[model samples]
Target: MTAAHRKIIHIDMDAFYASVEQLDFPELRNKPLAVGGSEIRGVISAASYEARKFGVRSAMSGKLAIKKCPELIFVKPRFDRYKEVSQQIRAIFLEYTDLVEPLSLDEAFLDVTINKKNLKSATNIAEEIRRKIFETTGLTASAGISVNKFLAKIASDYNKPNGQKTIRPEEIIPFLDALEIKRFFGVGKKTCEKMYHLGIFTGSDLRMKSIDFLEEHFGNSGLHFYQLARGISNSPVVPNRLPKSIGAERTFTENFTSIIPLQDKLKDVCEEVSIRLQKRNLSGKTLTLKIKYSDFTLQTKSTTLPYYISSYDLLLDTALDLLANSDLKTSVRLIGIQISNLNINQKKAEYVQLKFRF
Candidate 1:
């Protein structure tokens, strides 16, 4: 359908990992709980709402999280359980529309313009989906309904924790105008700082800038900002989207200065990546090695091979070579390896534009 008339819904589970842990463990309910971290080392994968009140957040170091909330309880991640719940939620989405794009285990976008139920109201469909999710999995979900994926995704976060919001086409302009520049998708902290320096703090400020002006200052992303400020997004929701890359990494409990231990870690990471590639029946021509120093500085080295390879031995050899040629500026805190430029047969999905009266 036409970009302006498409019915998109973004569903995001509230504190997914932490919520799941609470649901499974009665003692964790209504407590400051964190998933996938420890008091000594590692990063938090998710933090419960209670923990969030204490300034605990996902990606925060476990040590810092513990300091922020001394009573915080940590739990290891259960990926298999999360996967099972995700499947159940996916089934619920498929019941209404096949045009579902899963962003992750806990969030997805559903295009219900031409749904299986032939539903006329996207908002109603979203509510039903949320209700069904709670009934089926005993988990609360929030939803955003809008004309396109970007608006829908943003609306989803407006009323979180088992709430839903709908942004009709008529409200699109004003909704985006008053929105904070930092809330715009793809605008990170660095970009926000740059925009702030330019006196662009909101979408309204962004809309006042010309494409040429934006492009001169922000490069190609300037055009993106200009379009987004005007409530324009044409990106479609693609189902069963193929991943662009596959990789694995690990953070050391203690920074390592020796090459032997770093090499051993790289080998383990390569093995993990190789296994993942094999599981997906995928291989890539490009390999990248990522290193994070003790000072939190990051470096990456990449090499493209003539042939695609997913073998563990090949990956280890290439990664080891990359590591050997790299400078060890400081003790290493984290290391990662990724394979991109994957070999996959891709088919373009065709879309027909049709304007809808909302």
Candidate 2:
């Protein structure tokens, strides 16, 4: 019901960070560039289209990336500049519709079914937004238009880098049927292998199987596969879907049994969470500590404070106390710290001096 007769558009910026770098430094345009540190232990945050030609990609180790392209230029990320551009893009989206769901700093979903511009064609809106992005930020964005969010998102990737794709309702079935199983939204490497072994290589093959059979083979995920194969997705385009919680987690190569080592890990997790909160301009009243034993069993403990907190020291202290009071019968392989009940629009007066137990 949520997907019926709806018009959704997904807009994704082309090589956002790298593109921004190129825009700021005109000499870098049309050249191989990556945004990240060039340290031995560093990884690429983003790569320019030129660098991508040599198989250089974001998240790859700097050493490996440089091996692929010796001419790759590394530039440190300037998040503040990216945020400013994101705000500008969001402003353009709000001019046409209030139903804008941002996926990240450089991607978003816009529901223009009943927009302020009274536009009938979602494709037209997508083009206008793409044009505006280029004009305002000097960056190109690709777009996908369809009846639902799932289809729209996938279609957006069909034509990369300044292109747009539209999947009409009538064409959805054939489009999906021809699509490889690996291209489905939730199908990863393992899932693809499983599907291949089960003789399901494409959407058409998946469509031939009964929901019961698929579910029995893939567990709950089979239901999603079954629906997707039929081009049936009813997910909504939710607006202003702020994160419920913010957290940082780490899994150790070696399990830890001692309280001292675990406490040190907690400090790192808490610091990461605090940094994320500050970047988002958020504060939270609840603190949660999570632990995963070497055997994969998970346990979590949480407490609420009387006032919002965003300080690194406070978060670290609270997380450490939570760890101290936790059930530590087994060695932990993974640990995390999270904060919930966030106030994205927090005021200075919201902070209070109150000591609460973890």
Candidate 3:
């Protein structure tokens, strides 16, 4: 079947972490709350809608978030609880279709073209799923239904906080044409700025550029933009997707000038990565060390070993070696370690067969 005939739905939970906190704590309801941070330091992992109204957002420093909303309450993250609730939600998706691709604990994509219930209207299936999620978990979710994942993902955010939107195939062109360039998936702040400098501010502006011109300016990603501008995304939703990497990082409250403190931090990060790799029963040959300087400049060094390793001793040795040989131009504010090129069983490629309509 053609790509345009596929039924895709993107479901995203509203302020997942914060919402879960509020649901469990009666007093937190309707109050500005933040999850996973402290007033003195650290970054917020999630912010409640009430906190968002005060300009508090995820990844914002705790000090800045408190400054924006002094009354904001912070709670520690409970990953185990979140995982339990996520499992409940996933069961609901499986009830309708097995072609569910979980993006995270709070969001997923479902290809319901040939669902278990044999539902024809993707929009109705989305609404039903949302209702089931709320009924089962007492959490609100929003959904976007469209012909493909890209359009559905964008539509999911249109009506947030327990609402859903459906972008019909016929509306894809005009909807994308008027959409802001910044709203397009994969277009980051830097890319948006570059596009602005090139006088491309909207989908229509992006569509007006030729493939050759886009490639000349944006390289490989240029072709991606060109295709998205024409509503041409063919990527399918694959279930049980394997992770490409496992990593961990730490940001220091104060930048460190001495190698001693940096080494301690690197040891802690390496241990965390090792634990994660062991938890997943995975290992990789390629190891990368990331350093962010006080000036916000970033540097990365990577080395690929002949054999896979997931031990803390090996990871720390490789990380320390990379750091020792690197040029330290400035104080380091953050450091990270990652292992990629994983050793995992590869599965045969599978595609969802869409039922074509007249």
Candidate 4:
């Protein structure tokens, strides 16, 4: 017999950036717009629903999107403002249950089987959260509720823009059997092509493939697909789990052989990393600097800081120092800064103050 069902709800805001823009400026309420850089070489971060109807999409090049829809209005992202909204929504989720795991600035998973309200059904809790987000933020959120996180995530997208759906335990079998193979979590474009060639187009088709054959073709990924097709996933909804690492990276469209441009890029990455670490209430003992060559070979150099390092100027200087000592043979394609061995501790000990570099 199967174990008792667990309640999981995945909440995702609809076109978060675009919606926020709409909320602030009522003039853009029904107009099509996108959020991203408006420069010659930039991509769309989010597109309003009206823009999406014209084939405008997030991550599409700004030039291409404009070609698709001539009236596409582009706006720059205000990350500080977005971060504020994220915190507000998170606070809303916490009010219902602490088992809330944020997937991004606008998406989260909530386990509400036995919530603060002592709710007995995931569907009821999903409705309440969705309603509250709209009430407080004036933004629409779609919600999916199911017995597991995987199904719940997919269901949230089933109906979007102020929608909510529930997949009860008894509905799991039909839900999996009817789900498209491409809709399976983590199945990318390449995996879909492989599955299609194997004559697996649906959950039923995937269910028929032997686990061994699937694994032989796709390696460990095959096992995950097999289980998902059969409505089996053991992944938990981890809540408020602090990050283990913080890193920043940048990909340059043009390869850089000059030292000036490389340093500029490194400085940019270090600043981003420092800001991220501070926002998360974290500090790291180790710093790693990474580089990718034009030919795609990767190299990294690291330093164990005498103490936790996070200030922007200090990190940039350290990364440059590390780069100076490394062997370089190719033009750089990408540069990055990473901090690891993360912990919440940041208070300096009295002993450290007495003997610092002394």
Candidate 5:
């Protein structure tokens, strides 16, 4: 089938963390609420719609958020509860089709072209999913429907906070041309600035640039830009994509010069990785130590063990051994440890495949 014949839907929960807090607390509903750390160094993980009206936003400092909205009530994040809710929502998606690709705990892409219920309209499926999510979880989800993932993701944001938008195949070209360049996916601050200087401020301006001009300026990504400007993206909706490796890293506020300090930091990083491995019930045979020098130079050392190891002590020791053998030429700005060649059992692998298959 052609891309235009496919049916895709992107669903995003509105103010997920903050909304959960409000739902549980009752009194916080319709009030300015934020879920995050309340310490001086704490950051806002999510802000309720009421708080957003006052210029409060996620990733802003807690202090700044409070200053912006004095009535903002801060609540600690409940990741466990969030995970439970995520699973509940995932189960709802599964009831329709196995083409559910979760982007995070609160958002996912669903290809309902050939759903279990044999739904003909993706828009109808999106509406039904939103209704089910609200009925099951007491939270609102905004949805976007389109022929492909990119347009669906963008359309999902068009009407948000308990809303839905659909971009028909006939509407793709006009919709894209009216969009700002910054609204295109992967156009970060730096890239937006570059595009602005290159006279590509909107999708219309972007379409005017020849492939050669874009390639000369943006390199390989120019091809993506060229296609996106013409409202063409064929990326598939992949579900249950597992991690190839598990790792953790930390950047030091103060660069470490001594091996002792570096070893201490490595222990912390390894512990973090161990926690993740345990959470995912995973282990690996290869251990890699990544180092970033004070001068921003990067180095990595890796060694493969005979058996998989998930213990914190073993990973720390292996990482330290690798670090010790490597030449210490400069102070370290960042340190990380990763475990690759993961030991995935046949049962788990089969489970992942079955869960993802349509």
Candidate 6:
């Protein structure tokens, strides 16, 4: 790998859903909590640290989670409120550098090799970002600083939840050697079992395996494993954190006809759009309604509002108005609503200056 002076930090919030629940409900503090569907068929979306200690985890069935931690408190998700906090935390990251890449509501990668503050050490930059996040959001985030994406991502997960780890270039080999096989990125349950059968149990064990041997066993994804084993990650920090358009659609168990039936389906679409818009912290100026006919033909009509809109009522009203303007044409099979003309993405001037001369 070519030498680089770049600094990248990966930050992940600790159990975002469960943390939010604790923040709102004082009773849930230090208790076992899982966030997701509260129903029998629902799965846990997030589990608090206390819940995790008892083997309860996100994506586990709520029933199974309760079996593990009999005292588990299940909470429904509040995406709108989560989005509000996401925006606040994001605002803090931007204070250091504009080259931030959000992976999800609770995680992001920031390239601060060249930042607004002209910080000399990436470690200090990470500390400041951590401090600012806690100050603004009342939540703690874990940070990992490294020269490349692979090391940085792994480092971030090392300490976790209100902690930070910095892996210097000189320490890369020792860090990789010390990690367990399961700790490697892209290696999950099934893969770990497979690796065990092949006598690959840790980073040192993986490094001794041949690249062609790995590819032969795991196919294309094996190439990623080979690079990760050597602590080589060339992925660039993508700076485009903007929505292309605000839209939502769904497939029904059965098709319907007429305005009344169609309106029922439209509600689901509008709700989805509102959730997406809130998550992206965006508003729209135009609403478009899409209709699909029984014959598989599709049509869409849109209307532009005079002002920017983020309110659920305004977005829903515009979508319904657009639907009312269109005819069934062919016994509508599906309907959807979309909002468009999104705001600019993250103020483009925030990107760090690339290092090498072209």
Enumerate clash totals for all models, in the order shown: 1, 0, 0, 0, 0, 0
**Runs in model 3 lying further than 4 Å from the true structure:** 252-255, 293-296, 327-333, 345-358
Off by over 4 Å in 2: 37-39, 248-272, 275-314, 321-337, 340-353, 356-358
Error of 5 at 312 (Å): 1.9
The model with the greatest lDDT is 1
The model with the greater lDDT, 4 or 5, is 5
Query: For each candidate, C-alpha RMSD in Å?
Result: 8.3, 5.5, 8.4, 4.3, 6.9, 10.6
List, residue by residue over 1-358, the lDDT tens digit for candidate 4.
1223678899999999999999988988888899984535456899999999999999887778888888888888887888898899999999988888998899999888778998787788888888888899999999998878888888998888789888777888788788898987778899899989989898889988888989999998878878888677767788876777899888776788877798888988998999988787666778898988876689999998776666687778778888888787798877898999776654652112222211
Highest TM-score against the true fold, candidate? 1
The local distance difference test score of model 4 is 0.83
Ranking by TM-score: 1, 3, 4, 5, 2, 6
**Local distance difference test scores for all models:** 0.92, 0.89, 0.91, 0.83, 0.87, 0.80
Per-model TM against the reference: 0.94, 0.79, 0.91, 0.83, 0.80, 0.70
What local lDDT score does residue 235 receive in model 2, on the 0 to 100 scale?
77
**Which residue pairs show backbone clashes in model 3?**
none
> Tens digits of per-residue lDDT for model 1 on 103-133?
9999999999999998899999999999999
Please provide, for model 3 over 1-358, each residue's C-alpha lDDT reduced to its tens digit, 9 standing for 90 to 100.
Answer: 6789999999999999999999999899999999977897777999999999999999997889999999999999999999999999999999999999999999999999999998899999999999999999899999999999999999999999899999998899899999999999779999999999999999999999999999999999989999999888999999989899999999887888888898899989999999999898888889999998877689999999877778888889889999998888898988999999888763532222332324
Candidate 3 accuracy as TM-score:
0.91
RMSD from true fold, candidate 1? 8.3
**Model 2 over residues 1-358: C-alpha lDDT tens digits?**
3676999999999999999999999999999999984745355889999999999999787778989999989898999999999999999999999999998999999999999999899999999999998999889999999998888988998999899999999999999999988888768899999889999999899999998999999998878988999878887878888798999887675779998999888878888898999988888999999998866689999999888888888898888888889979798878998899888655564966755546
256, model 3: CA deviation in Å?
3.9
Model 4 spans with C-alpha error above 4 angstroms: 1-4, 249-257, 278-314, 321-335, 340-358
